[model samples]
Target: MLLLATVLLLVEAATAVSPTVRLQYASYEGTALANGVTQWLGLRFAAPPLGNLRFAAPQDPTPEYGVQQADEHGKICLSTAGGPPSNSSDEDCLFLDVYAPSNATRNSKLPVYFFIQGGGFNSNSNPNYNGSGLIMASDYNMIVVNFNYRVGPYGFLASEEVSKGGSINNGLKDQRKASQWVQKYISQFGGDPRHVTMGGASAGAQSVTLHVTAYGGRNDHLFSAVASESQSFPPLRNVSESQFSYNGLAIRAGCASSSDTLACLRNLSATDLQAVNINQPFPGAQQPPLYMYGPTLDYDFISDYTYRAYAQGKFIKVPAIYGDDTNEGTVFAPKNTSSYAESDTFLQNNFPDLTLAQLGKINELYPVEDTPSFPDSSRFWRQVSDVYGEIRYICPGIFVSQQYAKSNIPNWNYRWNVVDPEAAAEGTGVAHTVEVNAIWGPSNVNGNAPASYDPDGVNYPIVPLVQSYWTSFIRSYNPNTYRQRGAPTWEEFSGRNYNRRLMFQTNETEMEGIGRGQQGRCAYLVGIALGLKQ
Candidate 1:
């Protein structure tokens, strides 16, 4: 009892420093911005999921006093080989950062804009996803939150045995745990627990949609609104279906020989775990396996297919904004395909469950030619690109929006058409991740636009325009009510306006409605996605 009491006392003594606001049992120090924004970096929301906690669900951090020096960015979860660049990766990396308005006293109550970074559910870093620039761009009274979550294998490993032994979706659960923590602690930062708005791009956007549809719309009141950019809801694998991936990874890591492989995995060093699992392509495989370290239907956090949940009205009903980029296929489109035979082989290999008849229909709908496709003569490759862009991005947005709109929920849709001339690949129009440049505005850290431009960088007019809509949306669930003069009144999506979308472009020098281009593309792709069930 003496030793236990001494340890507790030491912990309390280590973190007893005071700040403007105080957590339930701890205190934090943050950097004050020139504009009076108080910034906190690298705050722990949960205990480090290291050692035995590696693959386990996140546990709450010890709530004791210690001077939490939230000064520098924390380490990110180890990344996969193809993931975004990371400064460093470590098991002890579950942390969050925040930016609060200067006027945010402990008594102040401001709406919160929480963002999740996207890297195909494979990689993302808290430092790269700073919310300071977002605050600066919006210049609103809203508070912003940024954080790191596990990705790839350490975060998502699955099998029946593994599931029975513990649980899956550790990475996703990490986000939920962090949200729960926010509900408990954000008030200290002058953020209202009742008015949290969640948003993200790509995989991060996908996360937002999943949260909306999680447990059939079970609302913990953690969020009041959602915004997704280029969100995709691919079919998730069941534990039975995920076993092959788990076994293969275990065998490769030499954990299969152990009687308790899951335990063996937990015993292995984080580096060894990643060395064997990270970036190891399937042997002679076409597409990566569904259960290979991505979100799966664990039946815990996610009850069913996200689309099916939307279709069945099984998600939290909240106002939302969804958007995609035009020419999304150019960047992710398959390449080096010479003919239909090769394309057929690729699909058959990637989607083994797809029958030849269905594949043939898909091919018929997306016929290819030797026609030139921008910067190259490989026009035939558009077959795959067309389908990929629609299936993974465009259609998914329309699919979810249609379902939610039917329920009379206010939904907004958009297609970002602006492309950076020098940055784009030959023939590829506005590819993925372009809208992010517009949303966060230009940053010296990761600037994509050419140096020398107006306040919004080369993104100019479009950047400022987009920031207005986003900040407005964050402030009042609607982006159209308030904005700069001459800005197009953003339209709300509904069944009547199902086909229309806000088209953001540079040439038009203004946003416009896209009522006809690529008409029926999303409808056809939704059909294909639904047909997959049968």
Candidate 2:
């Protein structure tokens, strides 16, 4: 009789209550992401960025209790003006999403991988990052973390206007405080506080480098490993607003530039604040737009140049995995073409210091002559793939690794040469966000299908191999050196050897050896980057 009554009660409860459960977190909690993975979403790590909180260092999220629900993503820091669709945003948006194994309990202490999303430092979030395969497939229990922070002028506006303490890189401070929060509270969610690996792609990967280098010593005991995919190191160029002595939007909004205080700028609406970074006439300058709306040398967040910071050994010495794809420029290009003419007019306008002879030599060294011809359909794509890849990614990325490697740091490199042959025919090779989609499953890239699936519903088999190597690095700080049953041996980048880079592909998994000088114009560009006479 008792069993029957209990069954009846269970049925009644199932029908009466919502399928999801609500719980309050450290602060500003919510009900989002109650999918297959056990989720704790929108828990604040820092204080709301309203009024007084503006420009100040992040404040700890005061623990609060109440039956709060977290069944979906909360909000993003509203898009920078007329950028993209930014639904909900608030000063209280410094919240993180924690995804753990459904079977994981409070007692299961697992390694943690904190992902910093990439949007050229203007905006991003990890809630959109799917950990289904990385978590379930690895079987080695782990905690996945993603969060959101301020973007645009609200994030990286630096000037004398900050003297009143209402200026600087608030976005970077948000990340720092978020990391601190993870160190403090992740254990409750079954994460090993000490085994954290900070990882990201593009700008986020740059952030990992900056965090370790600029904000070193702060969390020496916290993060042990880092993986930076397409991470651009500092000394980045082409930030229109940043180059000027004052904030670009401030002047545009009729604020007096003569004033050296952030009072007027801080009072603007978040919408208006974001307008400063909107549709920034796509970076035509020498440098890639890694942080057009990102952290600057705020006395606290960034004290010096990021490259200098790393070179001085001021960064946390953590094992790192950093590399980029073969063609990352397709992410952004204006009618792609594989060639760029170094006109005398352009040289005079952009690099006035260079003589005609110098400019010619520069072009010759970083040659754009006699290149591969692309089909009419793929012409534009090839240009974007070549020029942009050289300037924006390949050169900078390799420079970063070589710089760190010179310092004897434990750094592993890979070139994601995997391209979908069909996609290549469509003019998009192993494109910019291809690896990202493959690693984390799918994103809203093509609309109908998930990010990883091709037209024929083919799933890339390389996904597991890449994920396994990544997770292994996250777990033991060692990328899987184990040769597959019939695969070739993966090698480390030793100076004794010229150039050895692993190619993570779809079917043909292998590593190739080549000459660093002959492979590409990386060494020549490095000289230009270091300011040595060509």
Candidate 3:
């Protein structure tokens, strides 16, 4: 009888250990996402940012209820009403998702990629970012992560009211906290903490730039590499000015007075507080007004401007890949309405470095002969869009590349110039978000289709190539050796004189000149965009 009972107990233990069931994670008061080879979603990283924690840095996720189901994503970060209502948001919005090869429970440590979503700075959530394309293209198992940071005033408000009490740049603080969380727990989900790569596009890309160049101290040795798509660097763009200088914004948000700013603001309802600063108009408010609440170059987090920091070689030396899509500015910028002479005037006045001869060469290459080429009353809009994208995104990206190249760091650059005329007629082309679907695969979200842009219908030919290169870089800190083995030999950046950019022009792939003289032309045009160097 003793032997029989022992045998029965052994059988029960064996049954409990099924290959299909990996582990269960609890976050958000007991919510769970079953971990295994297949897939899991909505794993909490921090506690809800509600009530007393509304405007403070996010706290580590704590269990509140019994084992909660994490099979589906949680509600998104709260967005402004009337726009797309975010589903995976809440005051407790810090969470991440996982996707493995259905049979990923093997003991080997796999490469991980933590994604940051783009919505200028004000909108977009991580739950909307999927990982199919990235996983399917390489053998490296992906731990695609997404988390919510405070948005608008509730998260970014920096008033003497709150600053006096030591609360500033709560949104950025949340990002740092999320990276810390990944370092502590990602391995439990089958990811290699030392082989992680953090990446994103647009605002997300900017976040990646910040992480590598400014917030490196917060990563705690979690990520091995970094990649950014369509990252921007505007004139006078400094982390310090953006974060701590809330003098104007504080008054606009009615939190100017330090005496009781935090107490008074904290007492108000979430919605009411969000409205306090709505009347204040910010520059570049048409898109991503969230920049109003971004991090400043303060001692608590960042110490200087990102570009200046990079130039001084104070950033992390991890291998990085940065690129921009074709016609990127068309979607983000407003219509053109200035004349060629006006554009010329703008450039000449701002970028004194460029002469009339050089400016004329730039216009000739990009073309501004026929004003009607653009429908707007003035062709200046087209000039601004093209020039702005080059100077703001492309030039800055390349500037970083040049610095990396000079430092002997592995840096790869690409320009996605493939423009679907059909997409462009509707006002969207290889816009900012176009490459996302190809990188992360198709998401189930509704508005995936921008009003003027089609989904491209078919899979992008270079999706695998790009994804493989990225994963390889994440795993080995070099894009040279991809998982699938065979891939294009991507070259490193060598400056304008010997420029070469991996140009993805169609369903077919190829590499070509780095626009030869176009890079210089773009730099000159940037003078106009920034009202500097013209």
Best by TM-score: 1
Q: Candidate 2, residue 370: CA error in Å?
A: 4.2
Q: How well does candidate 3 score on lDDT at residue 108?
A: 42
Q: If scored against the real structure, what TM-score would every candidate get?
A: 0.89, 0.81, 0.79
Tell me the RMSD of model 2 versus the true structure.
Answer: 6.6
Q: CA lDDT of 406 in candidate 1?
A: 90
- lDDT for 280 in candidate 3 is 34
TM-score of 3: 0.79
Model 1 alpha-carbon miss at residue 181, Å: 1.8
Residues 506-527 of candidate 1: C-alpha lDDT, one tens digit per residue: 5353434454535566666566
Q: Write the per-residue lDDT of candidate 2 for residues 366-391, one digit (tens) a residue.
A: 44443334465334345434545554
**Tens digits of lDDT, candidate 3, 279-375:** 2323333223323444445554566566666767877777888888866666644564466665655443323344567667767766755323444
Judged by lDDT against the true structure, how good is candidate 1?
A: 0.72
Clashes of 1: 5
**Which whole-number lDDT from 0 to 100 does residue 177 have in model 3?**
79
RMSD of each: 5.8, 6.6, 5.9
**With candidate 3 superimposed using the best TM-score fit, by how many Å does residue 35's alpha carbon deviate from the native?**
14
